[model samples]
Target: MAADITVIIPARNAAATIGAALASLVPDRSLIREILVIDDGSSDRTVAVAVECAQRHGLPMEAVSVRLDSAGAARNVGIERASGASIFFLDADDQVMPGSLSLLRAALERQSGAGLAIGASIRRTKDRPDKLKTPDGYSPDKRQNTRRYLRNELWPIAMGSALVAKWAAAHIRFPEAIHLDEDTCYWTALLARADAVTIEAPVLVYHHDEERMARRFITAPRGTFLAIARELDRLATAGVERDALQWRKAWIAQRIARQLIKHRMFADAAGMMRAVRAHKELGGSPKALQYRARIHIGRLTGIGAGASPTTHPAMPQRTLIICHDPPFPPTSGADLRNFGNAVAAAAFGPVCLASVAPWNGDAQPVDHDIHVTALTTDSQRQAASLGWRRIKGEARIPRPALTRLKTLVRDFRPDTIVVEGVALFKLLGPSRPLVRQLILDMHNVESDLADQLPRKSIWRPRFSGVRDLERRAAAICDRIWVCSTSDRERLRTLLSKPVPIDVVPNGIPRAEGIPTVLPQPAVSDGFPVILLVGHLGYEPNIDAAERLARTILPRIRARLPAAKLVLAGRSPKPPVRALAGLDGVGLVDSPDDVRPLLASAHLCVIPLAMGGGTRIKILEAMAWGIPVIASPLAVEGLDLTADEEVLLADSDEGLADMAVGLCSDRARMMRLRARAHDVVWGRFGPRAIRDAVRRGLGRNDAGS
Candidate 1:
């Protein structure tokens, strides 16, 4: 009879570890159908080690050699030669844990439809071993369909921990073009068509030695990122939701572009740019345009021209804006301002927005006019290390975020570099010499915000250190941008040296289909709603939402019993979500657009306790013709007068009183709405703001 499972081991220069890996599988020989060790152009004695281990245990084994650089390609060769019904992939440096094979086989037997069986792995360090946990609440030996498994489980789709049915393995071979994350792509492809099962027990031990760890940290080759992007594009074209896959494609293209720029791999970068332009979802994005601009500029400037005879026409000067956060989906005040500034900057010349992915999510494309690039480091350990380094007063660029930035600066060769926030000044370490001009876009006087926070706040201690760093960064930049004249003055006082400062007021795009009056309930039975729009993930917004639900809303409800509070934004943390249980408070997390919610509100409220930067939410509400009741802090940078342009309040009771007055007085509400809209259009409209940005860039360019 044919063997139950074909175990394929891809070995390359793993002589020292291959014996242990093969020996671990010997105990479960009865469960394994055949053992195939594909020596991938190894210079070491890896094949001998694997063969000896198999023979010593009286196991059925075959050995073959292939001259391929990628493990995925080697595995494809093994799959074609294997005769088993199921196939398991085991890296030469990793060992199969005891009972893992039996558990996987048992689970597969129970679920006939399951094409893949996955189990947890123990990541073994030099000093200790850490068990990688299964997704929370996952039951052992339970069968799950692909969609449900992918949606619910956070488990990695590594080859070492997966067993694929032969038919599925044959249908979905590993991607030969990419060396990085090929296993993930292969497994994703398989899971899209077949069911999968999970084994709760640890099944493999992934050894992380010094050399292997270093390899993991090295910047991935440009081809690797391009291969992943191509596969994602193919998948999207093959009926996958383009919206769901766009983020992943954006991330891959961003990384590919960065790496290409870093290594002066202009030809490859140009090819990647072309590929991104051809992609359905990414082709029209600002990120694709930025890549195109970068390639064109590089050709004209000979920035990364490696003996290429191709010539291109000279293009306008480009500006690269490096941010600490991705300015997409524009959920928060800071994100919205950054997005607006980036959009405005594009009008001056080609503008590329390079940002660090805030979370472990994929990068997203912004407006087509502004090129977008996202650098993502999916390492919790690296993040923790950076946090610790910050606590120790070290403000240098961390390696993971720096590698991509270095590549970007070298490739794009921008005329000016605009670092969006002082926190990201470390990225300037290597790019300072390459940049003709550096502009620090100070959203607010960060030091002042830190100084104003209570001593008991968790971030209080870090504020002083951060302020020192900002001061040092300010001294080096060519120019500084502040949202208000007040912030400009504050930054000048904070800085020890003189630097050019520009005041670029925050603005909003004109609203579509202007509403003459605030949206009221279509019917008489609808509740009078008070809308609070801001990203709940932000600490200040979270605090404001909690206070709104706990203190102010109750007072408003006492006066108007039918009054309702709607909290709307993206990614509300647990504490913010908990507010949904409160009476008269509704949470609308990750809404497609906050415009509809703003229209339905009788009035918008901004009861911020603490924050920096001008409030874009205030401008957005005004632009949408919604009357606003805001805290004094919310209107700090805006040229708005209390009671006329907007209702300004300080305390909880004062805010509640203003909200109650606005909802009850229709004529006063209309008056406030009209005045606020007029103020925003005249002072903070998109055309005026874009002009301000252009003028600021011109001044800096001339001065530099």
Candidate 2:
């Protein structure tokens, strides 16, 4: 019998379960040639257990002892002494599934080339051991497979599932320095020189009862990350995908930075982060920029909170805004409002913004013409900790981002500094005397928002400290800009200070700038479509969306069967996302460009139970010549007359009936659309808001 397979296991101190691994080979013994257990400094009775198990199962086994302390080095020894033509790498804590060996062997024999045969196997997670998860991105095409692997879209190719020909295996070696993901390096090397076929059958199971990679990383965090960086560099050199590799490097930097932080390896972590900024040239990469920004944030907090005193050589006067989140590529309601203000501020000069960013791609906010400085992702995380906020009595911007902002402040040399949102005004407290005016832009009355939310809401405002933060800002500002006179009145009462509040009513642009109309949609399946647009994650928006889908949409659809309600927005919460599954309800989620949806929509509906800010969505619909139907609260800030500029209703039944009436009455719809368009065009347009911003800056002249 020609049993030509050799199983090489590099193990240390694994005695209890090595017998199961040996027994798993017994059924396929006719195919197995020999087994090599390279004991890499094992203190337990591992060698004896392996020998006894192999002998008991009638399989030839070799026990080789080495004090190398590295699994890669022991694996190298296994390669050196292997007698069989085909070599399979297994771990002491893992085993081949029942039919996986025969399947892999057959797959190799059937393939055109003598190379690597990979089985679809699993690395069993600790919490769910019995449930096997098949590895993803297993295309028969090797090039696509490798690309997917580099991008991390493909799950890890476990070592136990790989069976490489001995001759091809001789060409490459496992990277001894990399303790984690060493097989990835070795397998990628093999994949380059030799052809590989991925078998569909299940092959191996890697159990997590043994020490996991995350726990092992606590010991050599820096070393592990550094090693990964080196391998990434090599992959980049080999002409793998540029963007994917860059993202991988930046993600690795973030991982290593956290690890170092956990182990209190500050100096090394800082050094590593700096090295990435200097040499990696990842300025355009959003993920990398996030890591670097987090590094900057560290310059103001915990250990690295001090910096060498330096100021910029005086730059030309510009308006700078310190906001909470990025304003570019305008995705959410905050982004839309911030973009409008930034545009208005830019009439002075190119405005600069300092905003928060996060580590994951989810929080990636891009820079537009207004040069934006990124804040650490932790700014929101730390700032939003309700318990921490209660204990500290106030939330402060992360020190590193604040320090970076100070540098930007020096360099930008703003005569007018507009601090957007109350959450971020803490950084601009009287450091440099060069600034002429400091304007506070109030987006909403936080106390009003707090009052509007249900008691059970986790975000329900417990802002005893937040009240103080606002009052403190009101006490020391040149002027305050509120979106509506209602918010102005609320602030006047809450702060009880004569801080000259200006009603800068939030604006939407005229249709001349953006493509006003997309080509009409071909299908009328969702005819007389009623649209609701906003950031779906916000509590008020979530409540409104759920209410419409669950209660109001059904009523409207019952009257006009083809009247479909469309909820379109960014970052939808679960309740809002769930609305899409309901009959007669459509959801357009996180669209890259929402203009098409807006242009094609027939009617805009806003039945909000809770809200504070002026609805930008209402203005957008009016601009597109679509009639609006909203609850009184939804239309609170806008200058619209009921049944004239827009239709208004307070109850769900009333709102649904109003929507049905508007869908059937084209003439009335046209009149409301025209009048509403006039309101937005006259009072809430770019030109009008610019004039208001100019007045707020105390400039009656045309130029800055």
TM-scores for all predictions: 0.53, 0.52
| Model 1 segments more than 4 A misplaced | 1-315, 358-367, 379-397, 509-524, 699-704
Model 2 is weakest, by summed lDDT over 10 consecutive residues, at 307-316
Report every candidate's CA lDDT.
0.69, 0.69
Model 2 clash pairs?
Answer: 297-400, 297-401, 300-399, 300-400
Candidate 2: regions farther than 4 A off:
1-317, 358-369, 377-396, 430-434, 462-465, 509-523, 702-704
Tell me the deviation in Å of residue 101 in model 1: 88
RMSD of each: 24.0, 24.1
Expressed as tens digits, the lDDT of each residue in 1-704 for candidate 1 is: 22588899988888999888888887688888888898876657888887887789888889887545568878988888888888999998899887678888888778877777888887777876575856333333323322233332456565578788887666677877565657756766776666677877888888766433222212233334545667766654434555545555654555566545544546556765665665666678786777677777776787743322112111234578877777764667767777777766654444677776534435544222355776555562245223334532233344666667668877665767888767676655555786767788888677788766677877566565667777788788888888988888778777888988888888773232334234443223445687888778877788888888999999999989998889988889999999999998999988877767766776777788787432877787787777888789878878788888988888989999988878788788778877777677657765557667766665333111
Expressed as tens digits, the lDDT of each residue in 1-704 for candidate 2 is 47999889898878987888888877788888889999875658999999889878888889987544458868988998889989998888888888667888888888877588888776676676565545555555656656667656766778788788887888467766566667766776676556777777778877864324433443334445666667766765444566656656655665566554443335445655664564354434675566555655554465522211111111112567767776665667677777777666554434666675433334322212255556565545554322223221234555566556667766655667787766655554652253667888888876677677788887775542366668877877888888887888888888857888898877873333432222232235676787888888788888888888898889988888887888888888998888899998888888887677776788887888887432987887787777888889998877688999888998999988998888788788777776776666667766567667767766644322
